[model samples]
Target: MTAPVSDHYSAPRRSALAATVVALVASVTGCAGTRAPGDEPAPTGQALVIGASLELTGQGSALGTQQEHALRILAAKLDVDGVPVGRTRRPVRLELRDNQSDPTLAARQAGELAGDEGIQALVGGTLPETALALEGVARKRKIPFLSLAPGAAVTGSPDDEGYVFKLTPDDADVARRLAEAVAAQKLRRVAVLAAQGSHGDAGAEALPTALKAAGVRLDRTGRLPATGSDFRAAVRRVATGRPDAVLVWATAPDSGAAAKELRRSGYRGAILFDSGAVAEQTLRGTEASAVEGAYAVHPMSLNGSTLTSIAGSALARRDFMYRYLQEYGEYHGFAPYAADALELVAAAARLADSLDRGRIRAFLETQVVEGMAGWYAFSPSRHGGMEADSLAVFVVSQGAWTRIS
Candidate 1:
C-alpha cells in the first residue's frame, strides 16, 4: 500500500486554506499556482477527517494531553465554515484514541485508523517510541503520518519515509542550539542526564558532536529511570564531576523530576533542556522551584508574537493562543505542534485537490508554510519539516517559560 515517491516536485496549484496561514511567503517564489477557469466545480460540503493516537492516559500524558487540546481547538476553528479543498470547503473532523504511552497500543491504533476509509490522514505520538511505532504502521499502510515527537530517526530517510513527516526540530538542531547557549555562558564542562528511551538516545548521540563544535567538553552522562522511578542515583552519578552544567534530555514530568534530583544532589550549576521539557508539567508544584532557572531550546512560537506585527502567521498564532487559553485556561507552548500538523495535512489536501493518501503524501512533501508552531519547509528530499531557524532559547522564570534568545 506504499505510495510511490515522485521524482520531481510540483508547485501547489492553489493557495492553501486562509485559516491555516498558507499564504505564499517571500522565500518561496513561484509556489503559488493558478487553475484554469471552469476547471473545477463549485464548493461541495464534505469533511476532512484526521485520525490521532495519543498518550492521553499514560507516561506521556502531559504532552499528549496538550496536543489533544490543540487539535480540538484547531478543528473547531477550521470547522467554522470549512477548509478549502479542491472544489469544496471541507470541515475538519478528528477520530482520537488514547495510546496510553504504549508503543504496541499506538501501532494497533494506527492500524485501525489507517484501515478506516474515512480517515484521510494521521497525527499524534508525543513520545519517541510511540511515534516510531506509528511510523511503522503508517509506512505499511502508505498513509501520511505527522509525528509530534522529538527523534532524529522518526523520519529516517526521505526515500524510505515517503509517507512520514516530523513536526519537531531535529535532535542535532536542538543539540547545536543548546551547545552554543552553554558556550555563550563560558561553561567548559557539561554532564548529561538523559531519559531511558529513544528520545534520550538521540540527545546522547548528538550532544557530543555539538558540544565539541561549540568548544565545550562532555564530562559524564547517566540515564534516568522510567517515569515514577527514583532519579537520585542517576543524578548523583552525572553530578560527580561537578560539571559546570547538566543537560536534562527528556520530556516532562521526567524533565522536572531530573531537575529536582539534580538540586537534591547539591549541584548548583546551570541546567539545560531540550524542547521536550517545555511542557507545563515541568514547572508545576515541587518541580517549579527546581526548574526555575533552567533553560530550554524550543520553537519561537512559545514566546508568541504581539498583535502589532499584523503578519498572517502572527495573527493566526495569536488567534490560536487566544482560543487555547480561553478553552483550556492556560497554554502549553509545545501544544501548537499538533495544530501545525493538522494544518499541514489540510494544506496538502488543498494542493492535491484530493483526499487520496498517495496524493496527500506527494503534496505534503512540497509544503512550505508558516505554521502556528514555527516555519516548516518540506521537500521531496526532506521529511523533517521544522527548520533550524525556528528554534530559540527560553528560561523557566517566575514559574513560566520566558524567551531569552
Candidate 2:
C-alpha cells in the first residue's frame, strides 16, 4: 500500500547529478594534497588534523577549560600566519577530545582518533597518566606524540618510551629544588603529604632521596588515595610527629585543602606545597592567612621577566595576561601551561612542514621555539627545556604569588 515515489528526473539527468556530487567531494578532499591555493586538491584533499586528548571535565577540568580556549587562539594564529599548512595555502585542523580525567576513557578516545585520515599527528596530554597511555599507542603506530604533564617514567630513563616528549619539568628536578630550599633553612625533620598516583609515587621516592642527600630526615609520611577529597586525615596523621616542615605533593585544590588543615592543626612551621599551586585560584581557596607564608618553587622566568625578546614584541611581558584579559574580562584565570603547549604543538606543525609522522617527530626533536615561557628549546636528549635548577622559590603574599628568592 505504499505510494509510488516521484521520479521527475530522467536516467540521463540522474547520472549527471551523481557525477556532480562525486566531483564536489573530490574537490574538497583534494584541497591539502596540492600546494596551489586555487588548484583542486588531489584524490585525498583533506586538511591535516592534530588530535588532543585532555581532561576537559572532572578534577582536572579547571586546567582543561583553559587549554581548550588556548587551542583556539593557536588555531587563529597559525591560520593567519600560514605556518605549516594554512599559511602555506594548505590548512591543518586541530581536533580536541575531552577525556574527563579518566584514564580508561582517555585511552578509548585516543584509539578512535588514531586512524582517521584527517588526523596526521597526536597531541594527547594534560596529565602524566594520559600521556603514558597516548605514547604507548603512538609508539606502536609510529606516530609522533607530545605530552605536557611531567612524569619521570615517560622518557629519559633506559627503559622509558623515547616516542614521548615532555614540555614540563619532571619530579627529579623538583625534588632537588625543594631539597635545596629546605637545606638553606637548615631544617632537620620533614613530614610528607602526597596524593596517590604517578606524580605522588615519583615525588614520594624522589623527595626522600633528595632529603637524605641534603642531610634531612623524612620523620613520617602520610599517603592518600587518588580520590581522597579531604586532606584532613593525612595532614593530621603527619602532624603527630610535629616535623620542622610539611612537604605536600598534590594538585591545586588538594594543596589548598592541606594548607587549611595544616594551619587548623596550629602548626606554625613552614609548608612546602607542590608547583601545581602555581595557579592563583588554587591558593585563593585557602584562608589567605593559611597561604601567607606557604612556600613552593616554580621556574625563574615565570614571574621574573617578560620573554618579549624571545616570543616577539607582539607578545610582550603581558602577552598571556593580555590574551586572557581579552577573553575573560578579569585576568589570571587562564592557565599558562596550556598556552605553552599550544605554542609547542604549533611550532612542530610549522617546522615539520609535511604531515608525515616520522618527519614531524624528527623536527620536534630539535625544535627550539620561543614561547611565553622563554626559549623553549628541545632535543631528543632532553624532554623538558627548562632546567630543573631554574626553580625560583616563592611564597603567597597579599593573595598573590611572589618570588621568595
Candidate 3:
C-alpha cells in the first residue's frame, strides 16, 4: 500500500508558519491553485474541507440519507484518532451537497465543487452515472476524488492526474456471480428489467453474457425509463413473456414501484434484483408478496453486520442497524456499504501519503486494500475485484434478508 513518492508529499516547516496568520489567496473554483510545489502553504487556520454529494431527496434518497448519518458516526470517531490510518495537517470537515436523485444535478454539483477554492477533496455518491458525469470535472480540477462505491467506466479511465478512485468490486464480476445465483435457484428462464440509469444499463448489458455462460436461457428483456409513477404496464409486459426469473437492476432509480406492481399481478417466479434496487426499508414498504421468496446479489461483507451487531450505538457503521432499530424502533436498510465505503476512503488517503489526488488515485489503482470483504485491488486493466459472477444471493425470510451464500 505504499504510495509513490511522486504522488504525495508532506510539508516541511514553512517560513510563514514561524509567526501567526500568514495568508494565501486562491481564487479558482473547480480547478486547484496551489502554492509552488516546494512552497508549502504554511498550516492554515481553517479546517480542511472535504466535499461530498449525496442523493438526499431524489429516487436514491434512502441511501443518501443513510450515508450522511453513517459519515456522522465516522466523523465522531475522528475526535483524537482520525479515520483509521488517518492523517492530516489539520482537522477535517465534511461538506455535503444533495443531488436530489437528478444525474445532471449531481454532475453540476461535482463541477461546482471541483471549482470551489475552499474544498480539498471529493467523496460520496451512490450512483455510477453521477460518478461518470463528475469524472471530467475531477480531472479538470486536479482534485482527489474518492467515489468509494463501484464502477470502472469512470475509475477505469482514471485521469492522468490520478484524481479518481473507488472502493467497490466491478459489476462485470458481480454480474457473473449473479447469473450463478439465478441458476442455483433453478430459475433457468430469465427476463431482464433494467432501469433507465447508468447502473441499470450496465447490468442489462452484462447479465446476458453472464447468464449465457451459465447455460441459462433468456425468455425476455426490456428497459424501463428511470422515472415512472407506476409499473403496471411494465409488469404486464414482463409477465406476458412468462419468465422463470425476473432480473431487475434499479440502481438509484428505485425499483419499489415495479416490485409492488409485480406483486399485484400475482407473478410468483423468483424475482432477482441487483443489490442497488433491494433497498431495506423501501423494499419492506413495497409489499412484493409475490416475490416473498425472491433473491438478490449484493456487494457486501461479513464485517459490517458483525460490527453493527456487536456495537449497538457509539460509532458503529451507519449508526448500527441495531441502534437505528433501537431508536427508530423498527430499523431496516443497507447501512454497512456506506460505512464501509468511508472506511476505505480514509484508508486510501493514508496509503497515498499526503492526500495528493494524483498519488492517492495511483495508490488505489495499484494497491490491494483489505476491506470488510476480501482483498480489494484495482488496476487500469482490471477495475474490480471478486468475481461478479459469484455475488452473495440472499432470500427474504421472516422479514429479513437472509444470505444463501
TM for every model, in the order presented, reads 0.89, 0.80, 0.75
Residue lDDT tens for model 2, 21-43: 24322332223222466754323
| The 10-residue segment with the lowest total lDDT in model 2 | 25-34
Q: Who is ahead in TM-score, 2 or 3?
A: 2
Model 3 is weakest, by summed lDDT over 10 consecutive residues, at 21-30
Once superposed on the true structure, which residue ranges of model 2 sit more than 4 Å away at CA? 1-48, 85-87, 90-92, 156-161, 304-317, 329-334, 374-377
Instruction: Report the Cα lDDT for residue 276, model 1.
Output: 91
lDDT of 1 by residue, 174-291 (tens): 8988998898888999999899999999999999999999899998989999899999999999999999999999999999999998999899999999999988789898888999
Colliding pairs, model 1: none
Q: Note the Cα lDDT for every prediction shown.
A: 0.82, 0.63, 0.57
Q: Tell me how many residue pairs clash in candidate 3.
A: 11
Query: Taking the tens digit of each residue's C-alpha lDDT, what string does model 3 give over 211-256?
Result: 9988899887777764655667777788786788788777533566
Superposed by TM-score, candidate 1 places the C-alpha of residue 271 at a distance from the truth, in angstroms, of: 0.6
Screening candidate 2 with a backbone cut-off below 3 angstroms (N, C-alpha, C), the clashing residue pairs are 29-45, 30-41, 30-45, 31-45, 82-87, 85-90
Task: Give lDDT for model 2.
Answer: 0.63
Which of the two candidates, 1 or 2, achieves a greater TM-score against the reference?
1
Q: Which stretches of candidate 3 lie over 4 Å from their true place?
A: 1-48, 83-89, 148-159, 286-290, 302-333, 373-375, 380-390
